[model samples]
Target: MTDGKVKARLKWACRRGMLELDVLFIPFVNEAYDDLSEQDKLTFERLLTCQDPELFAWFMGHEACEDTELNAMVQFILGRVKV
Candidate 1:
């Protein structure tokens, strides 16, 4: 329920999705993301946990700030993404 917690979760979630997300889209999404309410971020984070369909939903702009689990599997992905 805290923004800091959500941000931490989201940072992890972001790395997990690895997503093949467009680097170009980062600034745009980050800006829009900054303007979003925290609840929106949590929701989007949830949606992020799924496979391509849910990921595509965010990419396609159908979902914003969906809630997705940021677990050990995600952390593993985050580790790979870090390098």
Candidate 2:
């Protein structure tokens, strides 16, 4: 299969994961990251698919975005909400 095909599949899977992110996450976004019960946020971060500015924003309150963007997001969120 072509690179485009692989990328498309990845995007689709990421979208599906986004649904999970919303279901499992949205409620905790506005809360201070440090205030969260550590394990819950760690679990969400581990399971989340679209990890990106969108997710970070969603955590802070923004749009949901792509699959691989998660690593940067993990960093951003941790950095932004550090203790």
Candidate 3:
């Protein structure tokens, strides 16, 4: 797929039931997603598959993601937003 298509799909996937997640994800996909390596991009996609509550915990620093890759991605996003 084209890069725009990929980003468009990712932007859609970034939308969540939670507003907190939306603020984090939409901006990340818009401002940062293009800069990611292919591997990291895939990892981001994998992160999207995760449940919202788990993602919330991870993002909020209340819990850690057991998957190192996912954790890294989570941290990376948090770091970017300083949240």
Please report the candidate that would top lDDT against the real structure: 3
lDDT of 1: 0.48
Alpha-carbon shift of residue 27 in model 2 (angstroms) = 21
lDDT of 1 at 19: 41
lDDT of each: 0.48, 0.46, 0.95
lDDT of model 1, residue 8: 59
What is the TM-score of each predicted model, taking all chains together? Answer: 0.42, 0.24, 0.96
Put the candidates in TM-score order, highest first.
Answer: 3, 1, 2
TM-score of 3: 0.96
Q: What are the RMSDs of all candidates, in order?
A: 10.8, 13.2, 1.1
| Span of 10 residues, lowest total lDDT, candidate 2 | 24-33
Provide the lDDT at 61 for model 1.
Answer: 53
Best by TM-score: 3
Clashes of 1: 13
